[model samples]
Target: MMLRIPLNLGLLLLLCAGGATALAPAEATGAPCGGLWARCLESKCCATPELTCYEKDHRYAQCRPTGNCRPGFHHEDPVQTPWSCVVLTSPAPAPGPGPAPPPAAPAPPAPAPAPAPAPAPGPAPAPAPPPPPQQCVDKGQHCVDWAMAGECEKNAAYMHEFCMKSCNLCGNLFTNSEEGTAAAPAAAGDGSSNHAAGSSNAIDSSLRGGR
Candidate 1:
């Protein structure tokens, strides 16, 4: 029988040979490296070691330990890990738009007009004064007799003289005298002989008989 080493040892030898082959530096082909083992470093594809990878179109390359692969990159090693990369960039503008215009201000309300002043009241009417006393011409130039007694007597006397002077105009002098005579008798008392006798008696009593 031919002598046979264990199949596991043979497989290990084959794997070590494959690893050596994979680690060998290759000429840059400028061709896209395909499959999970590929990564782009500095715009080129480089055969990375197990679990090491880098971002595409980046300036730098990164190498990680075994079982650490970049995120979003497939790996045949069954390792899930996080990767950091440069974010895309955009240029800042020269001058930004100016600040928005301020909102319009509300208009102020109009002031109320002043009320008109009330009119002033008119002046009160003046009280009327009492009339002056009547004057008598005959009394004096300035004399005004309020009692009128002297004025009345003078008026009666003047009327009498006026009637006497114009007797023809007056016409009833006899009738006036007759009324006066009747009034005198009533004043004197009828024929009092007692009064005359009393007077004689007084005279006789006053005298003594002649010798």
Candidate 2:
């Protein structure tokens, strides 16, 4: 039995180089092909073999370079990286943006330490200096008269020590070592000579009276 079917000119079957009729393949534009860095599906197919497909996760995947370059980077096609690949940044999402951070709080000022105190008056004046001590002076006013009357020769111990200025022994107070040695011996010798001379004069006077 022969099954009859009407043929349309536009839907005609394709012919092969072998002179035989064959079924035609589906059109290329029938299913969409991804471009470079374009979103992809589980099939992971791309428009060109240089641009391969990769699945980032179950929900996210994209078409990227088949070279060593990973995500978050890029490279030049015909220049420096003609054969190799660098990192390729992923495509952005279609959703809205996220929220921002909170604002910072203000700080307080620091205070000053110890307050200024009142200063005291200046220091007290220094004390006055004491009066200078008296210089060396003779003890008695009769010192000069006694020294001149030759009392120093008779009483050398007292005169030389007490009447130092009159005895010409000033600054040698209370001392009679040298002056006494000279005066004492000479006074005793002179007194003996005067006694002898007076005795002779008395004898002469007595003899004249007898005559």
Candidate 3:
């Protein structure tokens, strides 16, 4: 019994030293959990003895010590006298691609050509010139000179008279003096010859004097 008491005292002293280290203040010894900085706790009951309450603003925060908050968090009054579990914000998402280009503008339509001008109206044709007068011709007398002088063409009767005068083959030729005056003296004593001479002499004198 005396030897067992000394060995048990040594073991009890070693166990007390380990318990003091394991239960040390969380701020002085960092976190009790290995390497893990702080825990994400929702409930007020933290499993680890070293994990105490912490906060930022008035909400619950991580299980870190006072004044030791994660990035994006500022130390605030503790809702649970030490700390609480409350998330400030989550991470933002990323961006996307882009939009497509617009379609090309349609080409403008061609302009229509101007309509052709209407043809001008033509002047009415002048009335046809009147026909010239027809010339008159001699019958069978062939009076070309009279026709050329415009006399025969002017009057056909004048042409006939002119043709007759120029030919002189027609009408009375000898006077009554040459017919019976000289021959009447030879038979003047006879009653028939004397009457005939008197009639011839009267006719001859009247013709000579143009009476």
Between prediction 2 and prediction 3, the one with superior TM-score is 2
Give per-residue lDDT, candidate 1, residue 63: 35
> What shift in Å separates residue 54 of candidate 3 from its native position after superposition?
44
lDDT for model 3 comes to 0.48
For all candidates in order, the CA lDDT equals 0.43, 0.58, 0.48
Per lDDT, what order, best first? 2, 3, 1
lDDT of 3 by residue, 1-211 (tens): 9899999999999999998877755543443332123433333333344444443445334455433444442346333254233432221223455677788899898889989999898999999999974333334455544443445446756665655332221234312453443333233336556677999999999999995
Which clashing pairs does model 3 show? 53-83, 54-83, 54-84, 60-84, 60-85, 60-86, 61-84, 61-85
Q: Model 2: residues >4 Å from true position, as ranges?
A: 1-90, 93-107, 115-126, 133-211
TM-score of each: 0.19, 0.22, 0.20
- What is candidate 3's CA lDDT for residue 102? 82
Better of 2 and 3 by lDDT: 2
Please write out the lDDT profile of model 2 over residues 74-159, one tens digit for every residue.
35432222222222233332356667667777666677777878788789898888888444456788886686567777999988
Models ranked on TM-score: 2, 3, 1
* Tens digit per residue, CA lDDT, model 1, 1-211: 2335567778889999998777643433443432243444522333333333444234433433334434564454344443453322111223668999999898888889999899888888887887884332233331222112233245656533433222211334323475554443343333345566888998887785531
